[model samples]
Target: MSVQTWTWILVGITFALYFGIAIWARAGSTKEFYVAGGGVSPLANGMATAADWMSAASFISMAGIISFAGYDGSVYLMGWTGGYVLLALLLAPYLRKFGKFTVPDFIGDRYYSNGARTVAVICALIVSFTYVAGQMRGVGIVFSQFLQVEIIWGVVIGMCIVLVFAFLGGMKGITYTQVAQYCVLIFAFMVPAFFISFQMTGDIIPQIGMGGTLEDGTYLLDKLDALHTQLGFKEYTTGSKSTWDVFAITLALMVGTAGLPHVIVRFFTVPKVKDARKSAGYALFLIAILYTTAPAISVFSRTNLIETVSETKYSEIPEWFKNWENTGLIAWTDKNGDGKIQYIAGSAIDGKKPVYTEARGSYGERLIANASAAKNELYVDRDIMVLANPEIAGLPNWVIALVAAGGLAAALSTAAGLLLVISTSISHDLIKKQIRPDISDKSELMWARGSIFVAILIAGYFGINPPGFVAATVALAFGLAAASFFPAIILGIFDKRMNKEGAISGMVVGILLMLFYMMKYKLDMFGGGTQDDWWFGTSPEGFGTVAMIVNVVISLVVSRLTSEPPVEVQEIVENIRIPSGAGEASAH
Candidate 1:
């Protein structure tokens, strides 16, 4: 079968399975919609949480970023996985014991103030919306490539699919659907890795293959480092980022991962506090399966791409190159008219007009020139590395199609989970909790469904015109979460003296500071300046680490000045710390 035919078949089958699961596990009550009836088994919840957490960034773009960034990319592998440890050890069990429907519920009750809940709701929406945008973009990328549709239409299609499951089944439906998605996506991701690993290193395990010697008897990392240096790029093992920046980015990502509202909400679905802890362990194990392999996949794909395309004649370029070129992700300008593509690194020369290159004539000949007059002639979009990996490795069509299905499954499952959070925060936390505490459950469910549709539309818009590459955009969302929610949640659990004044103020300032930095650097707001203008050389992506520290400091100072949390709230915290009787304690 052709690529398109196989893609249709595989994607169709996966969607059918998801739809069936959604129908089978359709939510019938507010409890089901919000927490899957709060009776999900640990193993099942773990798989669902893994799917909910991975998103399109992990499935489609993480390896792509690592392929290009080399060792700098290890931050993501360490940051995301390490954060799960924090979740399991510090937050998940306690939150499960505190056990309400959402992250906002804990903040509201713990702080004894509706204002705190409102602030938490806003933070959740911002974090969830930002994260969902990237997932939608991932969906669009897959659709544009496989379905041969415009990115806008692709996003619309994705939105519809998510709506079908999220609106109908809510968390109940989403959980089961995610379990299925996890299976499909993990299998799809691993098959390609196994194939590439065996072909490159004669080893079947991707992790081992990455470290093993290549067919040419050269160490894989040694060859990759040599290739990078020969092209004036940083070594594959030693990255270019300053030590401080790497530490900050990694820390921010770890904290952010634990703070993500959607991820935290997953703990609410399990039956007991111990179950939540076990679920976190299961989740980390499942997630590590991909996280560990990502770096290996990155090494393989990067090496494969360099060998296959660099210095090759433009006319003799592989079919995969042409296919990607049509997507406008791969481009070249033959500045010297050498008729060969140059993929080396080069420094930018000031005052040089960028001679934009375009493909021309029957042979699709194109000039290759760097926009900044850099040594490299080709600009390969980082987002395409994972999606195009199978094609580049000369895999069979069915495997490629399975990858497409996997990417979509990754994207749609996370999208559903995020949209549910956004809708739940608005309908349950904002409306039902603050505005109409006496609202009927049916009415609240209707509001939740309505909010989801609106949220999906907004998410789709951002997806069609993403702010950055998938992983980078997602990193910013993590930054926001880390800055705003992590501090408050952590302090709420550990410090019985933490007051509404402290938690609310800390969340507001932290999120606002993060938003200011991101907007200034990423969105070019406020007469934007370059990285040189960044404070202490902290890039916008890593600035969250600084902001999180500021939040902690400010919360501590403010809490000391303000009256402590009420005695009842302190008792509630004490109760949550105990493991036994958690099921009964949480019921209240």
Candidate 2:
């Protein structure tokens, strides 16, 4: 069968599987809706957490970022994965021990203030909505690309499917559905990778293939390094960024990962504190499988793409090239109006000087004008590398179809997780906690569904009208999460003396500073120019690291100057830390 037809079949089967599981596991009570009745096994919870954590960014964007980012992209791999270590060791188990259904529940009760809970709720809504927008768009993009539907129609169809499962079963439905998504998505990701690895280097494992020798007996990294040098680019492995910038970006990602409301809320489904710890450990293992493999995929795909396109004449470029080119994902302009395409360094532009100079060429000497000098420039969107991997490597059509379904699964599972957090914050945190403590469970559930319905429309709008590239949007979202919520959650967990004053102050400072910095560079808030740059030359993607440090410093300073929490609050912190007194387990 053709790739498009096979994609529909694979996607159909996957959706049927998800819907069946969701209906079979429909939620009955508020506990089921919020925490899956606290009976999830460590392994199941780990799988669900993996699905929750791996959003559109991980599935569709990260490899693309790495493909172009070279050494600088290591920050994302290190930052995102490293954050889980902090989550497992410092936060997840304790939060689970606190035995709350949602993040706001812990904040409100521990701080003994509804205002603190409200702040947490607002922060959660902002982060989750920002995140969901990208996931929905990812789903639409994959559908439109592989299944040949219009983007808006694809998005609408995706939203209806998600609503069916997310609203019907809530956390109870999302859990099992996410588990299935984890299976489909992971399998889809690895299969083409395996084929590509073997095709390139005779290596079955992509992680090894990244550093392995190619069929020509040359090192893979060496070839990439050589290609980059020829292209007026830096070395593939070592970053050009300052140590402080790297450190800050990595730290921000770690803190942001630990603080993510959707991820943290997954732990609430585990039966006990110890189970949460075990689940986190397992979740890391699952996530590591993909994270470690992603760089390999990036390297292999980039190498393959350059070699393939470099050999093709402009007139003879394949149908796939024309298809993606129409999307503006791949564009070529012949500066000299020559019919033949030029793939060369220092000659892509008509009058601009080469990006590299011989004096400081650490990536090695350039091979200027290696191809024809029509000075044709090729602009390939980073998002295409991963999605087109199977076609690039000449893998089977089924594999491509499977990847399309997998991409949708990854995006949908994450969207569901984010929407759940958004809805819960509005219904449970805002309405139940503050507006009407005596509201019926039915009313709260009704509000939760209503909030999600509204959130879907708003998030869908952003998805259709995305502000920037997928990875950049996601990075900014992470930056926001790092700034607003990471410090509060960490202080609440680790420090007995951290008061509501400290938490509130830290969140405000962190989020506002991050927003200001991002807007300055991204939206030209302070006038667009080289002069309106970051304080230490950090890119907006890496600015979260700075914001996180600021948050930690401010939180510590404010807490030290203020009085400690009351005896009750101190005991609450201690209780969260311990493994005992985790209440009765609910039915699985």
Give the winner by lDDT. 1
lDDT of 2 by residue, 1-588 (tens): 988789879989999999999999998888899989888999999999999898888988889888988888888899999888988888887777777778778888877888889888887887787788788878777866765555666677778877887898899999999999999999999999999998889999998888899878999999999987886677788788888778877877788888888999998897767788788989899999999999999998888777778736666765566655433345555544454445555434332222222241122212232223545466566766788878877788899889888898899999998889999999999999899999998999999999889889888887776655566677777888998888788788888988888888888788888888877877567764353357887777678878887888888899889888899989888766665455433113
**Given candidate 1, what's the lDDT at residue 107?**
89
lDDT of each: 0.88, 0.80
Which candidate number maximizes TM-score? 1
**Every model's Cα RMSD, please?**
2.4, 6.3
How many collisions per candidate? Answer: 7, 1
- In model 1, the runs with Cα more than 4 Å from the true position are 346-362, 365-372
What is the TM-score (0 to 1) of candidate 2?
A: 0.91
TM-score of candidate 1 to 2 decimals: 0.96
